[model samples]
Target: MTKSVGALTVRTDPTLKEVVVDGKDMSVYVFAKDTKPGVSSCDGECATQWPPVPAADAEAAKGLNQELLGSITRADGTAQLTLAGKPLYYFAKDTMPGDVKGQGVNDTWYASAPDGWKAGVKRQALGVLDHPKLGKILQDKNGRTLYLFTKDEPWR
Candidate 1:
């Protein structure tokens, strides 16, 4: 169960908790960010580094400010959480609380608006490099820009 203070509510999950950063207690939200639109922008071995954060039990987050939360479908048919219509995500490199090593990472990965990284947060987001192209980022190593490997159907 979550507790609220005034217009702000503390989001609680077994995995997320309230921690102080710069002396302010902010709720840590877990989700993905958009490199662009429609088509996802991460792929290849890079995907292993910043794997998209999936909703644990899509149904687990029902009701509770339905207006503030939602999801968008990815090209891979997976749902990404949307807060105020923007998809949310977490950086795999953020190994511990208060580590925003992913913010402004490569001009690709970003902290989701409205419910992500708090002020004074430091992020090194490098996942945007992995998502398949929604538009087109510059070429990476191997002279490749964007790539995705189709799973053997029955898919998986």
Candidate 2:
């Protein structure tokens, strides 16, 4: 699938994907490292376990127009990508495109929706949702609405 957000062009394989960040085309996965929408949390030694969602040079990163391309400071004080104010990250084990090798891991990391180009609500939005049967909603930092994981047991 070809998904675009700001300057990011996400090319998803049957399992994995390649996304453009900081003006460079880097690989990402369908899964995310945290409950936040388009962001990640793993950094430093944590990054050693789960790699970062690569970003381009600081100047280039500023070129990204997608609202979801927000950044967060890591433990080491480096900026990391955040979606809807939440951090974004990638898994180390996913070796190939279209490979969802990190689907459901550690009960925290899982597949991410292609909401990188827009603002979205957080997973927490589902809590106050009028409809409990509606399931979990995913949002980018822009607060734009996006995908909702329907499985009750998936995120838990």
Q: Please, what is the TM-score per model? A: 0.43, 0.48
Write the residue-wise lDDT of candidate 1 on 11-86 in tens digits.
3323223221211222223324343544345645544555544433332122233344455676667765544444
Residue runs of model 2 more than 4 Å from their true location after superposition: 1-7, 12-45, 57-65, 116-156
Report how far residue 120 has shifted in candidate 2, in Å: 17
Q: What C-alpha root-mean-square deviation, in Å, does candidate 2 show against the real structure?
A: 11.4
TM-score of 1: 0.43
Worst 10 residues of 2 by lDDT: 124-133
Give model 2's clash tally: 23
154 in model 1: Cα distance from truth in Å? 62
Q: Candidate 2: lDDT of 146?
A: 64
